[model samples]
Target: MQKLSPVPYGSLIFAPMEGITDEAFRKTILKLYPEWDYLATDFLRVPSAGKYPLKHLVTHFGKELSDVGWVKDKTMFQILTSHRSFTVEMVKDVAQLGYPWMDINLGCPSNTVTKNGGGSSLLLDLNTLRSLIKNIRENFPGRLTAKIRTGFHDTSGFKDSIRLLNDEGIEMITVHGRTRDMMYKVPAEWNYIEEAVKISQVPIVGNGDIWCSADVDRMLKETGCHAVMVARGALKFPWMAQTYKRGFREETSHERLQKIKEFFQEYRTQLESESISLRGLLKQSKSVSRYMLDGVENGEAIRRKLLLSQTPPDFFDILKSL
Candidate 1:
């Protein structure tokens, strides 16, 4: 029942990573590091044919929709859809569910999403993007936000995209400074983010390649964005946001390893309680381990063992030895 800024000044947000930032993962992260200013659900894709039923929306959002505690206020619901026909009605349903914050996904670059005329592909067609935003704004009375890449293939349309979002009353935009074509092959172009902040009427949140507490400060100082959103960086260092806000303290290698071990143990427990089968849990653990063990000592070898792990106990045992 209370409205909040989607991207408050100096806020730190945990980016919505598909398949990674699910309900269980969010709960685990919040339990360990509750300092994040906002948390976002991985985007819920709206079918082009018809409006999503209220029951289906509730199921997709999981328990966060029903939560009335502080977590509800800190969490935001995100949706992805290229079709404008059913968008307004679906958003109206979302409003009735009592979410005060919502975000449209305009940055996803996966072939499946783009080929369907959704995600970054929408950047190529401002007309459709404009119609979608205009309709959703008229129907949804909440903080309407968007996440975007600079452009589909180049930076030519980047400024225009920002202006269009501003004109449509987008309250905040998270700029992930890479064109859809560039993907993750090169470094993020923060200069474009700087340009966005300079020209936009709404607050901009800078996201890309932020891997540590220092990077968080550097992004804020460099881009002058209202906030910073951490994606893969959070997967690598789950405590990064808490460390940034509380002050980064030096940790010994042993201490870091212990913390990593404990974090995964908690994640494993959460997955088990959610009724995930051993095979499913193993798959998820390995997926996260790819990020978690990237820079740890002997991480490559540990990851190899982790990937080869056949059971949950074996997986955790390998992690514990690290």
Candidate 2:
């Protein structure tokens, strides 16, 4: 087992969620809770064919995403793929874009992804995983990492799977306890994550079912992982990363309300900075605000207002009214 220095590696991480970690969302989180170890971009789909060029792919990074500056330094640019050639070809462009780190995703459980022999499906083939990481290292020339589930169906390949990553010089690895079959239905098997921490030659970031600071401590205590990754937790409680830095203190109702107001204000500010259509900006803000406003007293009512908001001013009006 290995431990990384307590910089970004030893710090708490925001997981790369598909629709949740876009540019506006990342910016909002950074503004509110800048203590996060790093913010990861949602996985960029590396198509085996067709026009998956930088222009198309960059859109998912959203507007303000960059290789440097803001939101913690370890901003990971993650990709999902099964085809080596296509992934290799895309890696060149990714590196050229100046992204500091690139992650091979073997953790997403979507059928659309797995059925295409990407995502967790790659777990069933260690040789291919090794080859892809090796190819990426030889070609990309940047910090390389991979996020993986326990395995496709079980933990059978778990040890060798992480070994391939470490052996290939992957800088860090995040292990989500559920296999592809688990698909997040079951609790993330942290004991399995403990196993990875036991034998992994590189730093392991544990993921799954971590919803609070207590859970963070539990993951770290039980697994001795180098760090923890929070996904759904960050969505519902945007201040979660703050807990890691300052220790967990329950948010009072007044504090929650204040946080909500501040969060949306940042959201509006970020959207305006992007210079997108008001309609598009409202749609984007509403899309993410629902999570931030979750569990609040008037959450549903606010969501309804956002739904009715047709322009940026309307959106800001609703937020103000809240």
Candidate 3:
């Protein structure tokens, strides 16, 4: 199998989860730990010319976001579209913004996005896909990458589709193990991702079913992809990125619990600094904090109470009492 530089190929990555990986969350992770190799913004849905205002582009990556020190050069902006013209215009605008890298989302499975000829729908039209990618390359300034699934429904036409992308000079490719039709339901078909690794020329990143640092190692050992990106895993356990960076060696349950406590304390400090009200602060961590119980005792019960937590102090008291 081919090998990349010593840089951890399994560098934990935060998927461009719309509404979930926003500035508030990104800041929380960055401040708490610097485990992620790069951060890809949630897909910026661009319908047509004049539809996506510059401010819209700027808001997601605009002043406030751009100022986040952790995201500056490390962040990749991902845009979704069906029209090559629209894609080119958006690329051009982002180029003007001085971004060093950008990604095109061809893996989104949202029904509304697909019906509009965007996201994975472009997969059905190879010619349109090639045209749009070509426009992006010709217009955008820095690194260009594409994030895709194994295929739309069947893997039959996947090779030709991937070839078109490889031939177009994309800098990298990140493939989610499932197709558009599969959504996030079934286990990721690592074998199919193995097939893609053999065919694609650019560096490949495997993403799917990676729930922990060990999972990251196993995915790389099995797929031969250059890197692995973690979405739900990172969300489930914020320290996942940090854990991988520190290596996947086993830890005692008590040690692991200690790490969890540190994560919560650090995260709480960040929330407080955001000037969010105490109640609001705890509410924000509710969804993701539940993930910390992965290796803990009575984790499900803890997650249940935390999910239903009404206030910051209430959640803190529960955590303390536990």
Q: Sort by lDDT, best first.
A: 1, 2, 3
Clashes of each: 0, 0, 1
Q: Candidate 1, which segments miss by more than 4 Å at Cα?
A: none
For candidate 2, what's the RMSD? Answer: 3.4
Each model's C-alpha lDDT? 0.86, 0.79, 0.77
- Stronger candidate by lDDT (1 vs 3): 1
Per-model TM against the reference: 0.95, 0.88, 0.86
lDDT of 3 by residue, 68-151 (tens): 544656777888888733667778888777666788999889998888888888888898888888888888767788899877
Worst 10 residues of 1 by lDDT: 60-69
Q: Where does the lowest 10-residue lDDT sum fall in candidate 3?
A: 1-10
Assess candidate 2 and give its lDDT. 0.79
Best by lDDT: 1
